[model samples]
Target: MKRLLAMGCGLLVLGWANGMAAAPSPDTASVDKAIVHLAPTKGNKVQGTVRFETVKGGVKVTADLTGLTPGKHGFHVHEKGDCSAPDGSSAGGHFNPTGQAHGGPDATARHEGDLGNLVADASGAAHYERVDQQLTLQGPNSILGRSVVVHAKADDFKTQPSGASGDRVALGKIEPEK
Candidate 1:
């Protein structure tokens, strides 16, 4: 009888743990489809896609950008997730959660929206993957309604923290595909 009781307790605990692992947290959601594409600019044309999923603490943003000039360009999630306007002007400033000054994505005290730079190869393509726990896709400060921007130059990673990435070349809105 004692042995059976112990076995049952162990099984119950194991089952509970498994159930928790299989369940999705209320704050998390899967980004079924995030379509990022290139918009025609007066000079260059850049395009890409960012796929993400809500993890326990934050989100994982995976991206693939191509057709940019060969160099390091600033990449960021802007304040307004709108890419409707030409030249991708619809997307506003960087995502600034802490109300900090505009800076680099990896800066210690920069804007919450700054995401640093993307390095393109000689072939003019940039590929990257990153995880962010500070952004929400549906809540008050969700990144879902934001846009991603690719700059014309490398983000210096210093100097106001925005890396001085030049003109916004490529722009895309973070939206679920219909």
Candidate 2:
């Protein structure tokens, strides 16, 4: 009976440990889709990794960009997550969370898809970290089904919200990992 009791206690501890590790973080959830890949654009020079994290608040994007012009550049979550096309035209317009027109990410009245500029270093590298309270990784308005884009120009932050990045230099799609 003593040995049996010990074994049962060990099993319970093991189960509890497993449950803790498998449990999602308080402000985060199991990210259904996360794909970080590379692509070339016709305009700006960009190369880096993009990660999509599903948090309790919403979906988060962490971008590490290099080979840029060392300054402010347009960064936005596009409507489509398809970067299959060479020119990256496959990625649709900016993400519109409120179903509004395309605007800056910080714009008071703009699309939920708009995200502000990404600042690069003298070496032309930029690191972006953003958590969207309105986007998701699995819902209809989910950014997981969208694309992350880097532009060659800086978003004035006032001009219609989307700093009018001349063209798409780099692109990546957000998809769930297996």
Clashing pairs in 2: 27-56, 33-175, 33-176, 34-175, 81-146, 95-113, 97-112, 104-161, 155-163
Residues 42-112, model 1: lDDT tens digits: 57778777665666756667778888888888888877766777666778777776687766544567765
> How do all models score by TM-score?
0.72, 0.72
lDDT of 2 by residue, 1-178 (tens): 9999999999999998865543223222455547667577765567898787677676677888888887898887776777877788898777765667556665567766677788999998888887766656654355655678878888766665465786778988766666
lDDT of 1: 0.69
Cα deviation in Å at residue 53, candidate 1? 1.9
Can you give the lDDT of residue 152 in candidate 2? 80
Task: Give candidate 1's error at residue 129 in angstroms.
Answer: 0.8
Question: Lowest-scoring 10 consecutive residues by lDDT in candidate 2?
Answer: 20-29
Clashes of 2: 9
